[model samples]
Target: MDWDDLRIFLAVARTESLSGAGRRLAMDASTVGRRIARLEAAVGAALFLKTPQGYALTAEGARLVAPSEAAELAATAASEAVRAEAGITGQLRIGAPDGCANYLLPQVARDLCDAHPGLEVQIVALPRVVNLTRREADMAIAVSPPDTGRLMVQRLVDYQLHLAGHRDYLARHPPLRDLADLKGHRMISYIPDMIFDRELDYLSATGMEVAQISSNSVAVQMQAVRAGAGLGIVHDFAIPFAPGLQRILTDRIALRRSFWLIRHADDRASRRLSLLADALAQGIRAEVLRLEGLLGPCPVRGT
Candidate 1:
């Protein structure tokens, strides 16, 4: 079967419709349908089932997914190998949690673009983990490393978090002398059930089970904390961006977690991905250090 047919097949399987695949491939729906039929004929089996809603992958289609994806990866690697000479220029979409995207990605993008004038970078910030297998992003930066899938994981950098509060909020409330005092302060964080990663449940170890103010987005949480909505477990790198925020019980509550660089295993051979990943890792490490350095000394250990 033609590799182009397999490419179309993967697009349809991902989007679940001829029209959807057409939009992705820049082909008409009828043309996409004909290609899918041609692929089915070459393979001697129907690959999709027509349902009221859309095309659903049949058992045969399901089985073909892995090998077809491998073919797609190979094709992509071949094309990228040639383009590598053009100096890392292409659309590289990176999916990341909103906090990093909001607070960290702009500078990374600036550095990459300034270095490689032709490259276009897209930062897709979402509330949940990025789905690289589905081609949602060429790569992703994640707080928690994934356990499943043909993916490569690398530790990007470790960052610190601490219980923090707006100085106005701290002044309005009773003094926060220690960890035990957190029980009375309004705390902001990810909603308990909506937290997408265990590492992000930053308030859990503090014996606080509920968040009085919460949001799925870290930017929102930080904004709420800055607006004096509540005290929160916040990234030290981020605290400098939100003025008037102070790290509370810093010595007692300092926390460390890491960001990971994740990508499809098949992409290891692609120079574009490799270059982009290297740049991202270095940029993030430098940015994190630069931002955290902007923070003033943390609040005294107690009182």
Candidate 2:
């Protein structure tokens, strides 16, 4: 019945682990457990079913989801109203692909937090789709917009990817005169089956069938290329950081892809969410411009 108890329940349901929920709430695991027990007693019904995998919401808990979310939104609105008279203070979670999350989000997060001292930001670097409907994240950068969700989607920015290799690897191997020559090279790429998003299937466009070396992480793939393993597709924004890596066939081959910013429709009017979204979009646009300066103009129009 207490709003604080409902907040704990929401966190536990979203994270599905006592420790994870506790970390979000800044409480210890035992305390989170005790609170859940107290909440169940108040409701006079079991809320979560414990399983080896994690806590699963019971029927009673599932029924509480909508009301809990409504309460959360109302609390957010109230907080935002007060923030106008004071300053912004709340948590904002963003979900993004590992590549972007690892390379880009940290600096942006720091800047946002610095500007708003009381604000907290968490970045979920996940390869799978982040369910905005389930409150997995307040906002997400996705390859494609959802078709069925009640969401507000906007094109964030377009970035370029190109085939690249380490300077040492290029010197040791035959020169890549054309696309066909790539067939003989030990290409590095994502594990095909592990590519969660269709937009990540860069190899298919290259007409390359084999990946002699592969990894699920872009950071690993970049490391593989840096170690002289082989040529691989890499983001232009990432290339500037890896001094030894050089773009191959810059004019002949360029891939353009875009990231879409998505959030729940209900959160559209939230001042904090709107401000954060604008800041995110600006940061991404600035990065894209920097990448284009280094990689030459993007080959495709309106990516």
Tens digits of per-residue lDDT, candidate 1, 1-303, equal 799999999989988889989987789999999999999999999999999988999999999998998898788787877876777787889999988999899999999999999898999999999988877788999999999999999999999999888889888998878778888888898888888999998888667888888889899999999999888889988887898988878878888999999999988878778988999999999999999988867767754
Candidate 2: where is the Cα deviation over 4 Å? 297-303
User: C-alpha displacement of 173 in model 1, angstroms?
Assistant: 1.7
Q: Kindly provide the TM-score of model 2 when superposed on the true structure, using C-alpha atoms.
A: 0.90
What global local distance difference test value does model 2 have?
A: 0.85
Clashes by residue pair, model 2: none
Best-fitting candidate, scored by lDDT: 1
Worst lDDT run of 10 residues, candidate 2, spans 294-303
